[model samples]
Target: MPIWVTEWALIDWFAGPDYPDSARQGEYAEASAAMMEELSIVERYAWFSLPYWDHIPSLGLYHPGPVATPAGEAYARAGG
Candidate 1:
């Protein structure tokens, strides 16, 4: 048998300049309650991705502390 793991990121890179990419993503996450609710079909290890210690761009869920990123909030609300 084999096992698979996955993580997702809600990027807002295309949002207007007024909002930073992460901020835009946070806004989306606050509004993706429904979408988050529907992402409970994880048959294996599935979760949201976030920054990490030392600012390394790796598959992580924390960036030195409690991350309130839109995507993270959504993932938490959605039972991730």
Candidate 2:
């Protein structure tokens, strides 16, 4: 089964500093996609921008939810 990892801290870390908003977001998506492809375990993966306090901004990862499929089962087994 494939494993899905969501690290909000990592997103915050990467989104910090001199990087342009578009570039940072683009890199985040590209990296996540590449990771999924490399693992060959994920059926789907997604990321979204969210508003943070003081306009800091944040990102979120949403899988197919808690009852989707093999991915859901794996997620549950992994204590998602």
Put down candidate 1 lDDT per residue, 1-80, tens digits, no spaces: 44434554453346641333555555555555455454555245455455552542333444566655555665566655
- Ten residues in sequence with the least summed lDDT for candidate 2: 58-67
Cand. 1 TM to true fold? 0.40
Per-residue lDDT over 1-80 for candidate 2, one digit per residue giving the tens place of the 0 to 100 score: 87654432233444454323433544555554555666777655433332222333222222223122222223233333
Native-to-model Cα distance after best TM-score fit, residue 23 in candidate 2, in Å? 1.2
**All predictions: root-mean-square deviation over Cα?**
6.2, 9.8
TM-score, per-candidate, Cα-based? 0.40, 0.37
Q: Which one wins on TM-score?
A: 1
Q: Which regions of candidate 1 fall more than 4 Å away from where they truly are?
A: 1-5, 11-20, 27-45, 53-61
Instruction: For candidate 1, list the clashing residue pairs, or say none.
Output: 26-70
